[model samples]
Target: MSFTVAIVGRPNVGKSTLFNRLVGKKLALVDDTPGVTRDRRPGDAKLVDLRFRIIDTAGLEEAGPDTLEGRMRAQTEAAIDEADLSLFVVDAKTGLTPLDKTLGEMLRRRGKPVVLVANKSEARGSDSGFYDAYTLGLGEPVPISAEHGQGMIDLRDAIVEALGPEKAFDEDEDDEAETDVDVSAGSFAGEGDSDEDFEPAYDDTKPLRVAIVGRPNAGKSTLINRFLGEDRLLTGPEAGITRDSISVEWDWRGRTIKMFDTAGMRRKARVQEKLEKLSVADALRAIRFAETVVIVFDATIPFEKQDLQIVDLVLREGRAAVLAFNKWDLVEDPQAFLTDLREKTERLLPQARGIRAVPISGQTGYGLDKLMQNIIDTDMVWNKRISTARLNRWLESSQIQHPPPAVSGRRIRLKYMTQVKARPPAFMISCTRSDALPESYVRYLINGLRADFQMPGVPIRIHFKSAENPYEHKRKKR
Candidate 1:
């Protein structure tokens, strides 16, 4: 039976570093900055033969219950309560401080099994600090260098001993309840599957990966928390409260979804801080990997340049997008405001034509159902595919109606076209003088595909190749 472990300690104590080590991935952002991790992130971690769930939480700090830091501490406490064990990490290079001692006392009162981890033991002058960790009375400190990958075997032994054999080696406990959608090429491959027309079956069992992104303090976290029916993420009036891409698995109307709450992205010029840059990079990564993206906007001030830029970025990445005008409760004329938003979307984001814009209020939970429905619908359209026969018929009709412009007194002949892939559907077209095809013609074809196929608001890609000549080989070598 696998168990859950929570990594907790003061800021800059290498809690996140040890999390990355145990998870065997840099899933949690690690930096010299303290309190970089504000939300508790869970990962399926394996150490030696021991398989378990590990949670990386924000740095423990003494703050009032109303402040952001207090909310972060509450999250950490929740994680500790939920975990079967807690890894109380301490800085072996700096020794235990008042804050660490205070946190140790707090953990001791909870009576949860904790293994003291003295990180940075590989560094010089760490011996004194490592020895000092014994004073906390949390049992022997596992001295290891989380950064240099030293003493992992000892840490594994400690975990095994703490959990005991029954829980540590129980393989029949079943995996985590959450399901992850495989993003590998083979999992979503469509091209060359068959010569006949075939629509690839989409597995509904796997969780749908949806990313919620927007500018700072645009109510992204609030919207997610509302969906979860709990304060799963830290939210406040303060801007930039979230600095990491946090993923949560949830079930919506019997459909599984793995929702990602990303850090707020700012303009490139305003992203001068190193930590913010890291956060932005994390957000962009979420966008690239996600199957669908929701661009949240504050309804009071919608369609800002940065908002449009974010939408463009999502389109450029070829991910399915839905526009969410948040804080709609504050809008006086909701219908008129929504109409205006849709008009702006059409004018500003013509690339994602007919995009669904739902007015929502993250605070009051208004219009969340419609927003989610739009997201589901948009994802379906993004994964749509058209048969070769149907595409050819449409192409033939399109050509007859509006023929390709002649180049250099010669006509551009459109030959054949077929969908090579989906997931932001892409098509390959065979034509005469492919290099001479105008951009307008390509846009025309793309628009035709969208309109004729009813694939609205999803990015479509089209490529052209020269039609092979059967008479060239018969002409003989020169």
Candidate 2:
């Protein structure tokens, strides 16, 4: 059975730092900025033999009854109530304060096991606060530096003592539930799986797998909803409502397309929860696996750093990428928007060849058909494969059009090229000296291949390999 624990304290007392430490990852954002964390995040944690679930909550503040802060306090109290034990974290360097006293009394009245964590206690003069924490009446304080990895052993022992030996565990039902939940989650931790509604296998053919990605509240899910003619994903004025990446399959004009509705990605500076961390991982996985990726950005606020990160991931993973400016209906000027998008792409990510940017409106469905057509065209380009004859033929024609540059007064021989794989085509080229090849020249070849083959908006890779003449090698062997 999974036991629960909560790390409760005021803001910036290293509660999130300790949460990230126990989770064994930088899943929670640890900024010096106060109130950066607005949600209660939970993750599976382990310290020594103590395996359980740990929740990191928003800092508890003194609020009047039934206000926002009071509701937040209720959430903290409820999470504490739900846990098997609580870790009350405090800044040992600053010593005891009135907030500490108020929370101490609150935890005391709750009657749950509490372990006082004297955070930021690694340096000199920290002993003064250590002495002061004793008066809080939460038992002995474990002096520790969460960022510096101090006092973890004592923390582990405290956890085991509070949770262990309380009751006998039944492993069978627990394992069953965990297995079910894990399967539903797939690569992610918290999301439930789709119902396998679209098989993509009816006619011995599959449609293009296209995924929609962007920063949070950028109309990613909105685009998919318009294309499907319904709001399959819950839509609202609130941001961050769609926490799970949802997928739905449909036919778009003789093309079988699987569209993934992903949660809006937020910057790491903005993400502070265990759930948001899992959501980001899930979205990244979808981008990697999908054949074509259509990144949606809000027309008003496009090309933020987080959006750039999404675009970079798609390109790095070699997926065909199409940029969509969603909520075009709200844009006051369409021509200016497209111009700015082109300028942004050119300035920020010029390495991409055959990429496309389109303006779309998920709310009014104005440019929905054009977006679908672009996706189909892009997916077609991504899946293009060429035979060796066609590839070498193109190579010869390309050389005739503009031969490769000479190096050190010697003509560089570009012997051959052939497609190796194509879910976004990757090719192999045989050359005399690949070390002399500039990335710009390689990009030239890729662009020629894309233009001549009528492939666009899909990522392509060109690899140079040095190989000896096969006929001479065969003759020598004989």
Candidate 3:
């Protein structure tokens, strides 16, 4: 097994910077603001020959149990408890605050192994603070600049010393632990690539990437905690409590899933702050990379403008989506509320016709099984492929049922159709005057394909192309 280490410290001590440095990616959002990170974000870290799982935790703080800060502190404590080792970061330039000493005492009480990190040691006056870190009684301080890439060798040595040989990684093993699969790569099959290249043969051995996105306080994180059966993420009554698009690996019915909990996306006009913008961007990125997206909606106020906008964005990105009506326990009339929600969804989201909307309560774990089943079902539909001959047959009957409208006083004839790809199920249609074919006709064909092939909810793309002229090609040469 690989080693696991958690970075812990007071706010703005460069713990996240250190995490980004160790992981060699800007996976976590960093800024000068204190308490920017609230949840525990994990990443795979490799330091030359040594590799381990590293978790970046929220800064330790003293707050009431019910407050947001208190919950963030609780998350940090949990990470410390679960990790094999803890890297206690202290700002060498600013010296140590009273909170830092209190945190040091707390770590000491935990009885877990810890290495004191004196960050910003590259600064001219940081030597005094580096010397002062020894007073925390966590042993010698490893002074390094996480931003400037300074003293990483010393940091690696300190980690090895803290973990000891038994816990340290073996130098001979060439293979590293498998990280999350980027299922979003090559989403579109390019030219010279066959249709088989985009086929989605799900390898059950790999984790399915699912991203949960919704407005703030919509219980995106709560639903995940329910699935985990633990309070792994920080939650409170406050809006916009989650800032990062945090991802966690989970198992459902023996199937592995890497679920991402994204920040609540408000309307674009309200997103003026730089931090919130970054959080929203991260959430959007998650949507693009996910194999399936769950768009959670608040039962109390369902189908807000922003909610519809989010759904549209998911469909446009060509990701399979399942609508989750979270907080179902709050609704008084379950049947009536669900009926209204379904109607609204059908009206607002024509792009995703026949979409599945599961009523679930993140707080009480209601209807979670149904939601999981729908996710699995939607994924299957997203990967559905129709045979070329069957596609052409369907195209013939569909055109016969509703003939294409006359464009510029001439009939537009659709000659043939075939599926070019599966993940999102894109198809190409050869037709006369393809450009003249109206969008209404395209919608008609798309709706027909969805109903005929049992591919509901997943986005279906149909590209129209004029049929090649064999006689024109021969005569042009003559």
TM-score of each: 0.96, 0.55, 0.94
Prediction 3 TM-score vs. true: 0.94
The lDDT for every candidate, in the order shown, is: 0.89, 0.74, 0.89
State the lDDT of candidate 3 residue by residue for 156-224, as single tens digits: 999889889767875436655655448546654332254532433554454578999999999999999
User: For model 3, what is the alpha-carbon lDDT of residue 115?
Assistant: 93
* Steric clash count of candidate 1: 1
Report lDDT (Cα) of residue 209, candidate 2. 71
* lDDT for each residue of candidate 1 in 1-478, tens digit (9 for 90 to 100): 3789999999998988888888787888888988899999998787888878899999999999999899999999999999999999999999889998999999999987889999999889999999999999899999998898898899999988888878778775455534223444355546566555777665566568899999999999999999999989999999999998999978988988788999998899999988899999989988988999999998898888999999999999999999999998899987787778777788988898888888899999999999999988998888777788888899999999999999999999999889888888998989999999999999999898889899999999998999778899878875
Off by over 4 Å in 3: 170-176, 180-206, 468-478
How does candidate 1 score on lDDT? 0.89
Clashing pairs in 1: 1-170
Which has the better TM-score: candidate 2, or candidate 3?
3
Q: Please identify which of the two predictions, 1 or 3, would achieve the higher TM-score against the true structure.
A: 1
